[model samples]
Target: MISTPPPDWNSYVQSGIHQPNLPTIQEINKAEFAPNVIRLGTGELSPHLFPRERMKQIFHRLANLIDSLGYEEPKGLLFLREQLSKYLKTIGIEASSSTILIVSGALQALQLISISLLQRGSTIFLEKPSYLYSLHVFQSAGMRLFGLPLDENGVQTKMITKQKKRQNASLLYTIPSFHNPTGILMSEERRRELIDVCEQERLI
Candidate 1:
């Protein structure tokens, strides 16, 4: 049997260099030369808006359920999942707790999906000028990234058609409603056409 080269492992380690530093709000505010800074970089909600007393009470109740905190299920707390299912059903989306895979956040959700569905050299269609972090995630997964241009109404379906003509695309990644960065929503007609195209192309 031919010898395989030692796994090129170093290539996969995320480069720590060039990473930006994130200072806490208090630290930044305390700086001697602090300018009028309005932070829009992070997605944290306003602290003032959080119901701290209610949250404390909820946590206290949860802590009292057991002597020591137990390892939560990998999928997440079953009660939370059931609650989410009920909430989704209220909004007309049919979902079940068993079918849901709870993630820490949206980034983890995307990462998990990418690892499960994508392969090295697979082509992924994304909206032009889409979320930078998502683009980075796809790059890390070794996907061949392709862009579909957008207009006032959102991602131009015609661009997707043209791109598909040029190369075989595996999946069309979209935000559709309140798209990140641009916050543009896809029109109903475009949404219908996109669904049709996906069905015709057999892309999930």
Candidate 2:
């Protein structure tokens, strides 16, 4: 059940047009199955962990801004990006506010990458049994996904060459820090080698 996309979307997205839906979510909406449905699907923060008072004050300040009600810049609020840039720099990520293009959430970012960056039939290399494998966004985009084996450290970069030969991988998506589901973090050495390999392969 699919149709052509609106003209606003790029050809890459339009070419792979398919009806998108979460079957499990639809089933949940249709029936009540469990009192405590464990969601092992995505990386999500618990609502109980939120500091309500702190968020209330933050939103109160945001409401006072003159342009708060208006549509935000495509890149996102500059002030927020500037603050984020400073925070990332403190953690050794050298980035600027201008370079930070914000999206609503990880799902939005993935979908945007699929529509804007990924082409139909392009291959994406990722971790074996990753949360990415559970997502339909890439599949819906008509992109082929391949999962590489992982160890105690992280993905086996040694397999990169073999996987590349099997498929033309244009993108390598990874959750290096506190990876979802497995909760394993990639070692610094492994991270460096992975980056070097990606650079050498001209992967995004």
Best by lDDT: 2
**Candidate 2 local lDDT, 1-204, one digit each (tens):** 899766665555546555344687578544543557655444555678889999999989878666656888999988889999999999999999999998888767887888788877888898886774335778877778899999989988988877786788989888898877688899999999999988877778
Which structure among the candidates has the greatest TM-score?
Answer: 2
What does the lDDT read for residue 27 in candidate 1?
Answer: 62
Question: Whole-model lDDT for model 2 versus the true structure?
Answer: 0.79
TM-score of 1: 0.71
Segments of candidate 2 deviating more than 4 angstroms: 1-34, 38-40, 60-63, 85-99, 132-134
**CA-RMSD of model 2:** 6.3
Clashes of 2: 0
* Model 1 residue 99 lDDT score: 86
Per-residue accuracy of model 1 over 2-108 as CA lDDT, tens digit each: 99889665554544212232365346535623445544433456668899999999988888676546878798888889999999999999999988788888777
